[model samples]
Target: MPTIYLSPSLQPFNKYLTTGDEQYWMNLIADDMVPLLEQNGITVKRNTPGTTLGQAIRESNAGNYDLHLALHSNAGPVNLAGKLRGPDVYYYPYSSAGKRAAEIIADNLRKIYPDPDLVSTVATTKLAEITKTSAPAVLVEIAYHDNPQDEAWIRNNIPLIAQNLAMSVCEYLGQNCAL
Candidate 1:
């Protein structure tokens, strides 16, 4: 059986930000993906509190996981308090599989976010989650939390967001899923 790593973002402890803890959104995203993956006959090994995103992918790599997906919401220096929007799919640089998976996800997200241009791009050259994973890896920043509209969408469409992501993965792997 093929395994997939589901990693949600940990709480951000930055002092200047005023927003809900990100873990709640992460967990919701993880929960949303699990049933869909299971429905497609893909086994999921979720990352827990004790593990960093990179560690989870590495450990899963040592096992049987074919893919590693990290779920997150973005907040940027310019878009500080619910002001910026759009989803960004991040892939490990130089990995064909990672790029393919990101493109699939970007296509899926575009359907849901018809107004904005959803982008699939390479991660920052130094991010460990993309740089250190042995298996193909993609991290999805679903939307910019600093944008009120995006936050509202994140809050209201958790299931849709999760479903879109899972569908993309299944599509990339050519698995038939019921929903």
Candidate 2:
């Protein structure tokens, strides 16, 4: 069974700022995506201390996992707070596998996000999440938490969001396990 390392945000401020609270949505994502992968014959190793960004990364590299997917919500600069909106996928600029995974996720998000410009960004060298991973990795900022509309969508569409992402992973890996 191929293992997927699921990383959701553990940011302290997210609860205070978002409508539905952090764990509610994060768990919805993790739970929904996990079964979809399992149905497609992929085994998911959900990271515990589950919402911690750094701990998730550490676990993804701790063994022979096939993929590392970091999930998060976006927040803009203080001045642009509650203004920026959209789903943005991210990849390590130099890794081909990372780019492929990112494209798969971006393609899926493009279908669901109202933003026509939904796409992937190449992470800079200083970004620890993308830089330190040993496996193919992409961090998805699913929506802008700071934007009211985006936050509302996030609050309301947790299942759809997870489904879109799960389908992308199944599509990318071509997992067909009937087990």
> Which candidate ranks first by lDDT, i.e. highest?
1
Work out the TM-score per prediction: 0.88, 0.88
Per residue, candidate 2 scores C-alpha lDDT tens digits across 1-179 of: 67777776666457525455555566678877888788787878766534466777777788787778877788888899888888777888898888898888988888888784855565555656778888888888888877878888887788898888888887767764332
Q: Which stretches of candidate 2 lie over 4 Å from their true place?
A: 16-18, 50-52, 176-179
Q: What is the C-alpha lDDT of each candidate?
A: 0.77, 0.75
Per-residue lDDT, model 2, residue 128, is 67
Clashing pairs in 1: 82-146, 82-147, 82-148, 83-146, 83-147
Regions of candidate 1 where Cα sits further than 4 Å from its true position: 12-19, 78-81
Q: On residues 1-179, what C-alpha lDDT tens digit does candidate 1 reach at each position?
A: 66787878865542213456567777888987899899789998887765765577667677666888888888877535656568888887688998899888888898898465645465555666677777788888888776667777888898998898888889888888778
TM-score of 1: 0.88
| Model 1 / residue 70 / CA error / Å | 0.4
Task: Give the clashing pairs for model 2.
Answer: 82-146
